[model samples]
Target: MPIKFEIGDIVHLKKNHPCGGNIFEIMRIGMDFRLRCSTCNKQLWLERTEVERRLRKHFRNDEEIKS
Candidate 1:
């Protein structure tokens, strides 16, 4: 089964962002997803498939969630 995501979730991506941040918060979800980097506070837009593929971890309220 596919992973489920919520709007306010914080996630760690498999790859480091150019800004050297891997932590992000979900801003929008659908065919495309909008994420804001926790370190740089920069927003990114990515496809749902890409988001899932790059997802390394999930978090809520600063705690990690096991998949």
Candidate 2:
């Protein structure tokens, strides 16, 4: 099944940031995904194609937390 991520879902990218973190949070989802670095609070935009290609894993789902 294809992995689907939504806003507020935490994810780990394929590569670590210069700040030594690989984790990010989904801020927006569309043609491009907007992400905020979990460690440094830096915001970045990644194309959906690139996101699917570079996404390493999904961590926490906001929906799951409410249940």
Candidate 3:
């Protein structure tokens, strides 16, 4: 099954970013996704398929969604 992600979801990638951060926050999602790096606060745009392939894990805590 394809992974389902929502805006504000926190995700860990299979590889670290150039800034050495593996964590990213989902800012937007569509055919493409916008992500913000956890450590550097840098933003990136990636295709949905690429993001799905690179995703290692995702956090969708109920508490986070409520905030």
Candidate 4:
């Protein structure tokens, strides 16, 4: 099964970010994705494929979504 994503969803990536956090919030989705680091509040633009590949888990409305 594939993971579904929506704006404002929180995601845990497979690897930690440079800020030492693995969590990020989804900001925008379309041709690319905009994700904000949960720790540093840093926003990054990434391709959809990259986001999907890096994603480990996802949450919506504070509830984890099983994939």
lDDT of 4 at 20: 99
Candidate 2 residues 1-67, lDDT tens each?
Answer: 4467778888877988789888899999988899999999999998988877787777664433321
Q: Per-residue lDDT for 1-67 in model 4, tens only?
A: 4456899999999988898999999999976999999999999998888888988888999998977
Per-residue C-alpha lDDT of model 3 across residues 1-67, encoded as one tens digit per residue: 5578899999888989999999999999999999999999999999988888888777897333222
Model 4, residue 15: C-alpha shift (Å): 1.7
lDDT of 3 at 13: 86
Model 4 residue 60 CA deviation (Å) reads: 0.1
Model 2 scores a C-alpha lDDT of: 0.80
Candidate 1 per-residue lDDT, tens place, 7-61, comes to 9999999999899999899999988999999999999999988988998899887
Best by TM-score: 4
Q: Choose 1 or 2, whichever is better by lDDT.
A: 1
- Identify the runs in model 1 with alpha carbons over 4 angstroms from their true place: none
Which is the winner by lDDT between candidate 2 and candidate 4?
4
RMSD of 1: 1.2
Candidate 4 collision pairs = none
